[model samples]
Target: MKKHWSVFLTTFMSLLLASPVAFAASPAPQVNAGDTAWVLISAALVFIMTPGLGFFYGGMVRSKNVLATIMHSFFIVGMISVEWIILGYSMAFGDDSAGLIPGVIGSLSKIGLAGTAGQIVSGTSIPELAFVIFQCMFAVITPALITGAFAERVRFKAYALFTLLWSIFIYNPMAHMVWGGGKLFALGALDFAGGLVIHILSGVSGLTLCLLIGKRRGYGKLPILPHHLPMTVLGAALLWFGWFGFNAGSALGANELAANAFVTTQAAAAMATVSWVVCEWLHNGKPTILGAASGCVAGLVAITPAAGFVAPIPAVIIGLVGGAICYFAVAVLKAKCGYDDSLDAFGVHGIGGTWGAIATGLWASTAVNPAGVNGLFYGNGGLLVAQIISIIVAYLLGGIGSFVLFKIVNAITTFRADEEEETSGIDIVEHGERAYSQSIMTGESLGLPNEFNKMN
Candidate 1:
């Protein structure tokens, strides 16, 4: 493990420090105004999911850490945006390399976006800039998704560092393999959006961290109720709204495929929401807002890989199963297993994403988008097998890579909040601010903006 870590660090450092002069810059391609406009809109929409994710996770944690919990997602947006600009974009989407490792991990020839502005991505009308910005939104959300696993117990500094390193180590490689035309691309693996890349990588990382960090100070004994379900519901709505852009934008064109992805996204989410509510009602004898919200997100995650390959009918099946399976994972599996995933990141995203990728194998149809292949149901078992291979590769790489990085980050930074801070609350102690206050109306001890404030 140590040797492997050293090797990975050495390789990553080389890419990090590589000069941008290695590869000859290609002339800029003519970008379609309509495609550029659509991609821009999609990128903006996907970016909003981070805040929505913040609200969703925030509402699930104790009120004392509301601001801190929300801040994880909020802060990562700015932090990973910078990291992406630094070397992430280049490492994931740079020109193809002859080196075996570089093919799997991308070359740094395009590092720092040097010589990439007006260039058009090969075979697409969208500007390379639009593609870069769109992919940046993905990098931003992947680490934020992991925050759910260790919420209320993580040091903000450590989490931020993990985001930076994880983007380089785990997230970037997966992005390259699946979408950046790396090894998996050569193997004919399909991830129309990010079933294997974003959701699975984040999910595996979340589960690993939950196990490594152990349960929160209080395990199953404490009742960590959600502070606000409405906020979570609203967040769910925003994720649904943003996901259309996430799925359709993968088409990278303003064409029929994008239209199909748009409708399928809506169909899957709607059905999944309904199915989740129904499943919860059957299991617990009452349907909760949280269940419905989770189901909606689960459906979105599951359909993501197949959005362009499957029609509305198949999408409905995918969403329904996604909701039911995720419900089981969250409601039954997590409790039975006794791991405290504070916000069910692994349950919904990890499980849903894995299933979605497999389902794409079963339901993918070349008819929906000619660029894609037919699935098992559509007379091709090969695509399904390819999807499974991609899933396995993603699981091993994402899970193991994340575990090593977490240990390293912990060794250096201690990674988690101290017991006292975790108990007292991160919002007040870590951020020096409260989510709620009474300064204008009642000034006293714990008054105004500071927890240290005292009336004289």
Candidate 2:
């Protein structure tokens, strides 16, 4: 009996000693519950921004086209959400070594979220799944941002097709370059959140598409005013609320960096709001609610790149300058260029994001985030150079890629609505639905002449 017990103990010890060697190649992931919770919650917050964007763009279009405009955002939420799960995530985040174009995009190893059950995100204590969903929200919102540029006049089928392709070809590649260890990441560019990845790419692509799609009917000849100011204000509020999650969540941990991002985001937004109102009041003789909302959004866009790398004081300056510059872009540059960017997507986001990226190079400091390097103000001009190069790269990718996609989608389906469809309203023409039933009963749904329909 004693000899048998000794044999059992010896066997158990041998198996335990051999287990480490067998599993040495792949260590277990260490996930922090708090970090995982924060990332997931932040992802949910970002998800709200898409529908919030729908309301924002929806309120700015003519009543007849309200539902169609909102549908652009709503449908993208569904389409891109599915695309992310299937291929977008893999293309943006899979192993670069196995990628179709190494260092330019990710491989398909993570297709359908395979091999992600217990993996931890690199450099973080959260599950890879959490990171995946967070990035998915970003993918969903980016193309939705473009709809505002060509509001009220695009064909639904063309928009759908264009969005899907853009996500795969344009968005995925750019995201990989900036955040997924691609070219820009290797070049030492610093985009704390998504100045280059999300805002610049989306804004530039919006400009390109709007140019290709041409202006809305009677764009220069007639007035095109927002139908609901209150709704626009509401949407703006939601965007501001969600932005905290957008910027702070990039830290990927519940730590000091997240707190710094939160503070800077508020500071920049408030200062930009004040600056925009002041500028508008001086230029136009009265401060408008639209200007205030737009200013706040501009500030948000500008601070996004610098949120985790700069101090609050620098953030305020970034917002102030961003608000003023974006206002000029929307009020002066677009008017001078004579190209219709329907809701000022290019003016606000394009210009704001540009300024934000530059500001990051000017004000970034390692004191704020040890992982980040110093910027120009901190005696490192190389960071600024890297930022500029990244900006130029983003512009080329967004502009050229979007132009090609626009032509492709247009060939497959007519991209623009006909004159009759434009005159009657795209909502009924495209979706066979109206936003407000009262308009249908009152014959207002036909977009007949009304007090609000004054010509420009």
Candidate 3:
């Protein structure tokens, strides 16, 4: 009996000692000021991407509506900011009130961002406020992205209303479903950034609005190449810089994973650019700088969903495919579909996002990130299946949701301006400003709407 008791005691002591060692060897919970600071800076970086998007879209539009186009993004930033703080964050991340949608609309009250400081997120040491600010940038840009669809037309009054409603109904719910500690987040779906919530949703919604609003004045008759490629290139450069924050910031830290995400983001963007140039050169006999810029953006969108999951090598593969696929999607598919996307938002963001979702399922390896599941390449078929389901659900829901919302807006306000208003230019007719008064101007000022400014 004495010998047996001694043996049991020794085993218990050994188990106690080994347990802590095992836990220590697991993913470290260590935190430092540097990582936290990097995340805060990263949050700011993502915020700048919206203005960059504004400039890129503004430059491609006709000179008549340059300022108006830029205003679309700018106004969205302001409008969404107020809405996000008031109701958007609660709808997304507020506690699961009923387990139905998680967070009641009125539970957190309007603009009541109290008790958010010093509160840690479930898995990390970063404060909840850090996550809130990081996510606010996403809410700011998603709706702004849709402005490209109805560019050169649409009344600003109706546009503002549409932007507000869309953010509340569409963007917020999707963000909650995907990342707000809800059903989709628990379903093993992989979306490191806003590929589904931001890019895919915006792209599909833009396509829907364009379809409902009808084509622009010229339709298929006139050539409308970019008004200023140089401006577009500059905008693209800004987006490239801002994307490091967009992708890496999703990690919410300045650790090895953030570094990995940063490197992968750069590698994919480079590879996608090259792939686009090659494909364009082969098909059109020469690659333009415009194509290079488009390719870079396409690569950036494609890699967003997979940035934190896959390793560097697969990221390169994803980029190469992204360039080739998005080029065909824009140049060939849009032409065949006859849908006036106006800016290829669907082609680049939608198609590229789909590719990234699938590639993530194929390339994710647990060796690099044990917290994340391994993909098919790493002998896990279940994760690949889950990824496919996520893509299907996101596309169907986003596409159908936008269509319904646009239909309702169409019933209330005329989606398109009259023919004369469209032809004369939306900037002068809708807004009391002309983007270029020197080149072509009537005797009257834009706001007066006198006989000289009247449409012929």
Q: Which candidate gets the maximum lDDT versus the true structure?
A: 2
| Model 1 lDDT tens row, 1-456 | 999999999999888767454455665577799998999999999999999999999888877788999999999899899989988988888755743376577778777899897788888998888999999999998889989988888888888888889998889878988888898888888899999999988998899999998888765654567877899998899999999989999999899999999999999898999999999999999988998899999999999999999999999999999999999999999989999998999999999999999999999888898888999998999998999999999889878988899888898888877777887778877899877653432224334443222110
lDDT for model 1: 0.87
**TM-scores, all models, native as reference:** 0.89, 0.92, 0.87
Pick by lDDT: 1 or 3, better one: 1
Index of the highest-TM-score prediction: 2
- Tens-place lDDT digits, model 2, residues 1-456: 999999999999999999999888676668999999998988998899989988888889888888998899999999999999999999999888888787789998989999998889888999999999999999999999888899989889999999999999999998888888898888889998899988899999999988998988788777788888888889899899989889999999899999999999999999999999999999999999999999999999999999999999999999999999999999889999999999988898888999999999999999999999999999999999999999999899999999999988888899999988887789888999878765453334657666333221
Rank the models by TM-score, top first.
2, 1, 3
In candidate 2, residue 289 scores what lDDT? 96
Instruction: Please count the clashing residue pairs in each candidate, in the order shown.
Output: 0, 1, 0
lDDT of 3: 0.80
Candidate 2 residue 312 Cα shift, in angstroms, is 0.5
Q: Clashing residue pairs, candidate 3?
A: none
RMSD of each: 13.6, 3.8, 6.4
Residue 328 of model 1 has an lDDT of 95
